[model samples]
Target: MSDESEALFDKADTLDEIRDKANKNSNLEMKLRNCIKDSMSKVDSLLTRNDTTQAQLTRHNELVSFMKTYCHERAYSFQIKKCQDVSCNICTPIRLPQTVFDSLHFLPDPVPALDNPDHYTSFQAVYGKQTSEEFRPSLQLNQANAEPAPKSVFASGKIRDYIMCCDCGKWHYVYSDKALSQDEIQDFKQSLYTYDYSCGAPLFPDNHYLAELLFVCVKISCDTPMEILYYSSQKSENSDICYHCGTDSDFIDPPVKMVIGPKRPRFCGPTP
Candidate 1:
């Protein structure tokens, strides 16, 4: 038997021990057990065959790989790692927070509010004035004068703008405009990336579409980065500016066709 097949058999043994003790449903346990048996039989048949071709060996490798993955995923569902699909010019797989993966089924589509100027206006009214000092905790340990990190100015469940870091090409977050709660911010302050007002822990479960607000491609690129006030709920006049490159349609030096971004994904999780 191949090394991979042997490793898979070891995994099967582990699963057998886990299956008996697991609090999982009996039906799922039976399904997993049967799957393991079927996979083992396939492996044994291949190993004992008198004339196993290269093609058969290749297929055996694939089968063993699949079985290993299946056993792990089914046996230890909570430990499954998050995966992402690449969807933009950046050509990098943006690893989403586990929060996003957990909420993919329940998150609503991006409300088309691009036309309502007030949506952007109101957003600015609330969060635009927040300063870095406000995000910091009290430096002095004194009990009486110590102040807490600022509470989020933006209300929960609000979608705002996307933040791109010009200094580091590492930004891919779709700013949901949802500020982390005071407690969350406090917790985040201790993390390595918490030097500024960045999220320390993985962004707790939020809508993935909130991350999709800024993944558009615009025809024109502008020198000044203007905030595009888009009210995603509006059906007409969705394009006041480029969500991708921050180009104002009105200020196009030479009038060009308005930026019509390709259909953005409505939900999060996988790109498709």
Candidate 2:
């Protein structure tokens, strides 16, 4: 009887192993399918709009900015444990694109607004106080004992409510369930195509809320992706962190106007 019981237990363990493997394979397959489908949809939409002109490109650029915020969030799966068990061969080391990682780290570190024990303070939170004040806002300061905040806005595995427009200062609601709906995103692109994009508008500075963030004075009559030369240094190939802003990219050049966050704080010190 003991021999029979032992044999049955061994069989049960093997069956459990098979079930676990099946479940894992299903999960990976689902993630890959979603990613590929999303990419294909984007390509198809662009193809249909192949007659896109420069003005249309500007409009699409706006959509791209909005899409980028939403799309970039999908890069890592919140549902998956990035680190797996020690026995798992793929669990040894985690590597991400160094440039991307550096940019991700820039917003929350040494930004002056983010280093506080509470992690952030807006100008409203500071009100009648000096910038040098300890940014402790609440009358009770409950965050002192509150649980640490989640890293990403969409930690609940869903997109957030609305995206703020960089231009026109409007909010666009997004629906994540369907793929590539010709919603306000497409409309936004069309608006740019017809827009004269006249100059002399209040342009948002390249770097915002930096202690030394400054505006670029350009008199160009046309709308081009404005570059902000805050500082200069020749970096080696591997490092993508720009010395001033703590991030670098060929993408998302400055004067790319933004609506939300502490934008283009005026320098009371030296002019840039």
Candidate 3:
């Protein structure tokens, strides 16, 4: 995440003020940029109550610069890179914030927005700004016996164990540890991915508990021979149909893992 974005989240009140003013001026793009720009400036004053680090300060300027250039240099909407039917055409999987695709509304074909990018920060737009997948949290699982660290920005809790696929380079979270109850376990299970969405939570007294647990793909290797694989979901559909294949596969609790990840990777957990 950009330092400005990280620092700005807590300054909600300040963001609102600037956003209100920009909207009043009838400049929605300016409103968003003002919100983001004003958001970064107010973060320390309203939320941190202290100054940001020099490094962070530098990054804050960078995001502002990017925002400015986005409005100045390029058009908001554009073509998205996706799989093509053309045999020789490349179908590199480009995952952006759902918002990017959602804002434009999934059209008959994926076309770049005729609108401005500043108006919306789709999961794609925000995340796509990142340099590589390494910036993302890894789906690594430690030994079942090991204690978990703190969760990620959106999700929290001690992750006891997880699985990493060497072939496919996919990560799966496993919470079968003693720390998680049947309910908590179910919660994490149901919320495999789709963090921004509200309805995806593993519920209690789940009879067809298997009905939950969505498939979240971290990376779709074009090689077609990925070493590892895991599934996640954004909704609670009864069918566990594979994204690649429509066939419903039996949902495994521990996940039918033939491999593992690096040693004792830490996640959000109790303060040791």
Candidate 4:
């Protein structure tokens, strides 16, 4: 009823109004949060459905096994033709001409004659004509000097076989009759386990034949079937064409031959 009492009642009314407004704002904020959460859940469900359809499409577009095999065969053939350098470990061993051996400053001491004539004949046959020709003079000289020949040099009678490695592109000379050394066997096994699919150019220079040969050796040694599988998905772009020869499933069209005719003179402007 008094002026101070009325002022206190008005202040209490203002505080109640403020509290009601604050409660309303809190309710609105909670509704907004729930709305955002529901919307996110719907978006995630849609994305998952879309991903499943896309995965199916991708599987449908993938290359089949036969196509993959065809591409690999073409690529392998092209690589072999391109990598015919003499330095290749898979290439046939080059026998230096007699002149080269003669020119060397430090040639192996001339092979002495064998006590058995049959052994000497067999050795000569194994060496081939050029080798026999190269050493014939030295052998005659040694015979004249009456030097006794050692039989141990050709006692084994086993020719050394060259083992070509695909991974390192190196040749290892080993006797055919003897088993591979522990280190050599371990090295082969290591290579088998750690074979690289991307080996090409520079050191290898497009040599895949040796790698195939090495894989064949692996199959024989382990008594397991091994194969190189090429997948189109591995490429940055999905393509069925051969990387080396630019060939595809379509047959190559023959080049068009153009016949050139004489050029006509330019016409002058009419009547200047």
Candidate 5:
């Protein structure tokens, strides 16, 4: 018998014992009978590996109901396991370009925020700390005659450039304003196409939260480079676990913006 069929048989046998111990007209007996009649027959006639039969689907639903009753009444518990089976296809193991991975260099690790755990405070977070705390009676007196402060150069907005390492599947950006020329752009597109990409640094630095966990891209070894909206935030020394892959990584600052490329791709392995 199939593993699924054998499992159902075992469940049925267990339910039978429960049925015998209960009143003949009990709900337990009714539930078990319904499971066997509606679900088990489908499991018995299973014909293929991938496709699930309607009877098998019914069996699953019944087993869930049966278990719910068992757990609630008997105070027992069960856990659902995620499947991690691999496909037998020729395609997979998409590798990233070596140059992109090589280009990744270490940025100084950020200091952790004292209050908000997920954020790292930079120099800007502390720049005004000491000066702002001083009690300046003269400054307060001159405030009425003070002209509006001029806009800081740092506040003048400018777009940034980014590149995704096809191997790691992570996007990286140039902190400077040097744009890639048409030839360089074309060259990057051609060379990285079809190369394998596995996210190497799952805990790498990010602007806010790591962009890998927030963004999803499926560029084969051949597609043209794509643009994406990325949210960068202030990062800290502490890391947040990815909700999807469960990898530990840092978060970046608050503002989200468009980025052109990938950082080292965060590895998202098969989940169990």
Candidate 6:
């Protein structure tokens, strides 16, 4: 062959080699891109699983803490003493004290005055402020001015009373005067056991005396029979009364007082 023809053949071979290299480079780049995408997808999935696990761990920790604080064996039985005064008629219909009645004014009325005329009129006369638009009856006014009202039928001389757990010595308030039915007692117990720690304790108004009553009812119903006591006079040593939990009071330590922000800690117990 001529020299020029040989050079042309060599050039063709070089061109073919260059094309093969280019194709190989393109395939390598594509493989690298796919590998990076797979790695990133795995990383994202791992992150999601880690976050879920962390959330589960936090919830478990909260439940464990709550269980440590509240769960314990039944060491005491609750005792409620009804007023046995022959002349005192406070327990007939369970009338609320003046302070409790006044506190009700701040709450949203479930039944508006227009909806229930009789209830509204009676409530207004007793609790509502006297104004030109709303005039209270003369009889109620006379009764209000006549004399200071007597103490409540409650042993604490209030609409509600506090009783200490005989086992833990933690004070819990009782709001309801009437006894709970069997179904109600079981429901209360279920609620107490299944309470979610994630939501924290249920919030109640400062005057919500019934907040801790369910705890008392559950203890009385499930663990032991309630011990009924009687008080003839308000001066009786009722404040010192506690549930008859089998544990000795002398060995029980007082619960650590829990305080909320910018508010005085309650002596009875935590808000719940």
Q: Per-residue lDDT of 1-272 in model 2, one digit per residue for the tens?
A: 14543443345466566455446667544554554466535534452335367566545553454344333222122122233235533233447765543333111111145566445556455543433223324413655533222223212122322332344322222222223335534543454454333333222233322112211122322232222211111212223222222333432333324221222212222222
Mind giving the per-residue lDDT tens digits that candidate 4 earns over 49-145?
Answer: 2334545434532223222322223211321111235554323443666566344331122344567643344543344233323345555665654
Give the whole-model CA lDDT for all candidates, comma-separated. Answer: 0.35, 0.34, 0.35, 0.33, 0.36, 0.37
Ranking of all predicted structures according to lDDT, beginning with the best and ending with the worst: 6, 5, 3, 1, 2, 4
For model 6, residues 114-207, the per-residue Cα lDDT tens digits are 6576655444454434223232355456654442222232332232333444344433444344566676556555544544221112313234
Error of 4 at 190 (Å): 0.9
Name model 5 segments beyond 4 Å from true: 1-177, 201-229, 233-272
Model 6, 130: alpha-carbon shift in Å? Answer: 9.1
Per-model TM-score, in order, reads: 0.17, 0.15, 0.18, 0.12, 0.17, 0.18
Best by lDDT: 6
> What 10-residue stretch in candidate 1 is worst by lDDT?
263-272
* Model 1 C-alpha lDDT per residue in residues 1-272, reported as the tens digit of each score: 34543444455456565565333546545555666566555444444343357666556664455345422222113222223434322123535666665554311212213578333334333332422222122322243332122223222234322333343212222233445566544443343243222222223223432222212112112332322233232325333434333334433222223232342212111211
* Candidate 5 structure quality by residue, lDDT tens digits, 199-268: 3321223442222222222221222222222323232221333223334455332122323123322223
Model 6 ranges off by over 4 Å: 1-169, 196-272
Which residue window of length 10 is worst by lDDT in model 6? 196-205
Residue 108, candidate 4: alpha-carbon lDDT? 28
After superposition, candidate 4 runs with Cα above 4 Å error: 1-177, 196-272
RMSD of each: 25.5, 23.6, 22.5, 39.4, 27.9, 32.8
